[model samples]
Target: MEVYSERQRISNAVEVLKERQLTVGLVPTMGALHEGHLALVRRALDDNDIVVVSVFVNPTQFDNQDDLEKYPRTLKHDVALLEEVDRERILVYAPSVEDIYEGNTISQKFDFDGLEYEMEGKFRSGHFDGVGTIVKRFFEIIKPHKAYFGEKDFQQLQIIKKLVEKNNIPVAIIGCEIYRETNGLAMSSRNVRLKPEYKEVAPFIYKTLLAAKDKFGIESASEVVKWVESQFSKQDLLRLEYFIIADTNTLKPVEEKTNKKSYRAFIAVYADDIRLIDNIALN
Candidate 1:
């Protein structure tokens, strides 16, 4: 895999690739890659002639300084994993903070309005803006024919799709499935932070959502919420952040009157300060 730390080198490499008429696929990621991230790379490799993965821990996306500080960084392992996937076809661009955002000012910010203000957005203020800014920069730099994102971050995926449409960026945004472990817990880099006991119980998050989906059909939203809240309340080790069934597209609280429509049960919990997020769609 070719590694480029500077913008000029990356730009030149991309230009050469373009000159050769090779179709490019870009997978943008914050490092500490896991099976989920590799799944994305594998999919990209299948679809395009050249695969480029940008691993930069975006500073702007984190709402909490401690969370940002604690965010995992395993660059040596991440590169090894990429090379294992495909050494010849893969290109790794792992740049410094200064290299990415050269100037102090970033002009573009995507305002998703209602979409931005709900769910994860509500908890992490200006988080999506930071996501938008970095993603836009990466998109511009790579100029890939297609870009891939994992469906685990469904809301963020939706927002990026909207950004591409609104901005007229000429790249197809592809979302791959949420890769999980044997226990049904969605694969996430943050899973590394979990305590041994908490990691074992982590699969319960998915199980809870599955149970909640069944209850959604027969019960009111309030009842469902109460049941979910009680489930976490009883689990003394689990620190429930938010358990909500919201409009899949809007991420807003679905009214009881509108319960007939499709909804998604999204949950974020803290087990020993290692936050885990998961969601399940309901009809």
Candidate 2:
């Protein structure tokens, strides 16, 4: 439960841990701690001698300023949650924007071998760039041996893997399974912003994903898209933004299963102003 807002202090602390040859794990996050995030932390704790959960609401990732402002910042609550996880092994790094970006909060451009031009990238212009920038900065700052990421943002997870590959970063990147609610709705920080009515209907997104998963191998990938679209069309409360069955590796939308490659359904839906995204693997 030691929390550090200054980069230099945390860096120094991490350096000391490294000198002791203690294995360190990094769990990068944007505040608003949910069970989804804690799952990553708990796993990191299991795998490493120490876990550092960075809670900084990154500004560069948001294409819309309103969304950035509205994005929850709950470091105090987040720390409390981490303290509950394990007070001694978990170190919380809650940095300010100025502390993270050093006054200029602009994101760096990355190619990601055109991996950035897909689903989330197409919608949130500089989103992955911001993600890469911040995550890279954390890797530099923390220098952890292992890092954990949830598969909820499967595309982003792929991009991060590419980031490490491109830069030759030494850290091992781990993607954990998506944590869902008892009703099947994917756990998300944005779930806090869902309207009461929207909350009731939000579980439909996962229900449709489950059905789409069922149809993935049987139906054409394009047909699965159509079925998902029709299912969402019948619902008036939530709007389906985009749903594509993409290869688990390259993330290119496929019309039919080819070459024994794995595929997964990636979706983004709007519960009014709050956007929710989820994915499920299709084999």
Candidate 3:
């Protein structure tokens, strides 16, 4: 697999592919290639003539400096993992911060029609702006026929869809299923930071969501929220940051399930210092 760091080199490479009428699929990632990331790339390879995996850890996305500093950067291992996926079709664009942002690492502001007002957007100020900034940059640079993103970050997926719709960008945004461990823990790069003991209890986060899903229709949304909070309160290390059941489309907190719209249970938990987020559709 060939890897390109500079923007011009990859743009030139993608241009050559486009001239031959090749359909390129892009998978934007922050490195630390786990099974979850590879799942996206694998699907891209199956769907398109060429797959481009951009593995740069974006600094603008992190609200906390410590979190950004501690975020994993495993480009060598990442490339090896992608090599295992496909040696020829996969082009790894592991660019430097300067290469991505061009020395201006600041994030751009976006209006997502109140889509960025809750959940992750509420907690991490200007986070979606950073996501939009980088993802849009990639869209312009690579000009892929399609882009793949995981549904684990459901809110971000919706925001990106909005980004394309509003801007008239000609790329199909595909949201893939959430990849999980055998025991049900949602795969995340932050999973690498969890201590052995923390890892043992990490699966409980998914278990609690499953139980909450079971209680979703029977109990009121507020009642289910309280029950989820109580479940986390019993654990010493795991702390519940926020739990809300909201309409899947608008993402507004819903008090009752209606036949008009779909809903999902979104949860954010802190396993010690590591923050994990997961959501399950409750229809």
Rank by lDDT, highest first. Answer: 3, 2, 1
Q: How much is the lDDT of residue 188 in candidate 2?
A: 93
Best by lDDT: 3
lDDT of 2 by residue, 52-89 (tens): 99999999999999998898888889999999999999
TM-score of each: 0.94, 0.98, 0.98
Model 1: how far residue 244 lies from native, Å: 1.4
Q: What is the C-alpha RMSD of each candidate to the true structure, in Å?
A: 1.8, 0.8, 0.8
Query: Each candidate's lDDT (Cα)?
Result: 0.87, 0.93, 0.94
List runs of model 2 lying over 4 Å from the truth.
none
Question: Any idea what lDDT model 3 has?
Answer: 0.94
RMSD of 1: 1.8
For candidate 3, the TM-score is 0.98
Poorly placed runs, candidate 3 (over 4 Å): none
The global Cα lDDT (0 to 1) of model 1 is: 0.87
lDDT of 1 by residue, 206-257 (tens): 8999999999889988789899999988887788899988887777887763
